[model samples]
Target: MSAITVIINPYANRGDSQHQIDAGLQALATSGLAFDIQLTEYRGHGAELAEAAARNGAEIIVAAGGDGTVHEVANGILRAAEGSEGVASATLGILPVGSGNDFAWGLGLDKGVDLAIDRLRRGQTRIIDVGYVEAEGFPAHYVVNILGGGFDSQVNIEAHKIMRLRGFAIYIVAVLKTLVIYYRNPHATIRFNDETHEFDMLMTFVANGPRLGGGFIAAPHARHDDGLFDICLVHKTTRRDMLLMIPKFMRGAHLNHPKVTMARAARVEIESPEGFPSQADGEIVGNDVRRMVVSLVPQRLRVIV
Candidate 1:
């Protein structure tokens, strides 16, 4: 029952997170800080533990795994603050022991356990924006890094099936697998910043940070505290065209591609005639959602840098 709670996802990074737990906790102990640990036993367990901790008035709740872990912890903290007045949101800290620590990478927590612990001990925090998605049949989800629909969501699905590869390579292989297995794009109407656009799109991602899947620079100009989401639209294109664009995304040069559209907005509405797959922070949120609204909550989450 310490003030700082650390939620660890045992299966994250293919179980490497569990293996690294000792060293991570040892570092925290060496920092002379009192804390408590909670191990997630199943999907979404992190959020459950985090929510309980935040409600109990934990000052700092740390996600001791990867991006998915961070997403859950953030959501739990956000949910606890809902309808509660004059309560400061729990601060989030990352230990970054997962495979694709893209969100942690953006927060400068990818350096390893010791550095992340040092960051926590220093107590310097940044207030950052987080995105929320509301759709029928699904509870609201918080997107701390990126929320991707269509092609990228399909890629995430494929990536989950891959067992041997780790880190960025898994996403790279999944992208190739997606091209061969799921190539059809969906027609979507997107409204944001007082403008409307309708077209067949391969993918649309609303980003709070610059990277996804460990290395892909999906939104190169994104920032977490900007109070807006960086939205990228990938227009439908031939397989050959998609293959060519992959490299550009790696370096974040795809922003200028003729088929790609980049814009910043505080909120966005997406609707598709054909249902499309969607994911938030690398976790599949829905497989056949026809509509959803993504809006930025400005300076909502506090994170230890």
Candidate 2:
């Protein structure tokens, strides 16, 4: 059988991820599998480690951190595949030790560390789709879950500013702050799957998998292997409407609101009259740009459970 290499992010989950790693390793060892573990030292190190493991013939490369670590590792594996010859793709696995673990939640892998590790040891792999964002100023990259523009990106920016908070609190505080300080309706023209529409949108999210920022089910019906994306556009609304929608979002019922528009497409392009801020997988991208393209890569990854 092929060996597994786990790339760990020690700083995940407010620096409590090491304990999870210890538990995960114990479970893997109990499963009688030969595996190796590598800890990332800084930003982008996990991606580099994942690339090295893939090139070294690892059959499985597990991301042992949060969403950022997962994103970096996926990028590394894809980069390695693009640069290599005659190498089969390495399967990707996640042990959710991050604050949000939103991608894990989408996979129904939010049970706990032991369960996630057990699934990994069982070696069940499923091919899932990934999303990519390309724009004028930013580098093209992949997003395994949701990508956001406008108000949502501002939340991500604010959340990072107060990283000391954990999970939903970070997002909740950021949302309140954004609502009070930075809420703006940006005029945008969106084209998806050949249909074009214009609106003054509060935010636009292209979702491959549901949920972001811990528990907000931005796209409740998203399926990662469906070969399509759920595009949600929130029209300009009153602050009272935004406040009322928060509870609905917590219950994954925000789509019922009249101001929220949801559609499924294989590709989407957003053009803003004065540009907008955007974020993918909790990473900020772009400032003021004319256009942004979002697309999906179906069954592009084999993930553990």
Candidate 3:
């Protein structure tokens, strides 16, 4: 068997990921890497392929798509590890061939197939923290980058509806659309680090990395190896206030805003009487999420840098 397994999501980048995949495959071939390629046929197929590859003793499972693909592949690897030693036997790699390559960007990876393949050839790896989140009516899953609930998740949903744009522009348009169409913030109770905060929340973002939505610096100080999550809570505010905060987030300068609360924690619990939407690594986890428990797992996954 090949030492590397590449899971490609053909539907990434709004269904235009084929060119990137082809380029990545060519680079891998030229790099003298012994690898097997698998294309995802449906939504969660990447995870299934990754799990099977790990179970079969693949040394590396490369996610050759976007952040959603990375999310699935990581979940699969962790799941496979749970059956054996509770430690991932397969390392993870990323080819940022998607709209929002937030996780890859946070890892300091350049935005080219050749560059990604070069990193894979170098074979440098690091152990990074992973987040495990469980919510009502949703399967417990792993988050390798960030999870956003409430208004942030609604923006993600709107972003997916857009077809003409790519990258950060899509998220910008989505944010505008969400404000007009979905503005009701949920009443949330958040518990973390022996403190409970109750408020009408606009959103709650937990970050294992410093960025999301392509370029939004959600947690500029976050580090994947830190064994803790940087949490951002935005209190319910007017649409005008949200609009004013957008530029601040773009600059990673919103932490000091009066409506924003930023802290670091290893575990967090959130509940709401009004069910909310949530997305992890750009994949929508659930729409009617009433409760969520998130905890960090230190040094859980090995990743190629």
In order, the Cα lDDT scores of the candidates are 0.89, 0.85, 0.91
TM-score of each: 0.97, 0.94, 0.98
In terms of lDDT, the poorest run of 10 residues in model 1 is 80-89
What is the overall TM-score of model 3 with all chains considered together? 0.98
Question: What are the per-residue Cα lDDT tens digits for candidate 1 across 1-305?
Answer: 79799998888888756657788898889889999989999889899999999999899999988889999999999888888643347999898988899998887778888888889999999888888899667888888899999999999988899988777888999999999999568899999999999999899999999999878999988999888899999999999999999999989999889999999999999999798999999999989888999998887888999
| lDDT for residue 302 in candidate 1, whole number 0-100 | 87
After superposing candidate 2, which stretches have Cα over 4 Å from the reference? 83-88
lDDT of 3: 0.91
Instruction: Name the candidate, 2 or 3, with the larger TM-score value.
Output: 3
* Better structure of 1 and 2 per lDDT: 1
RMSD of each predicted structure: 1.2, 2.2, 1.1
Which residue pairs collide in model 3, if any? none
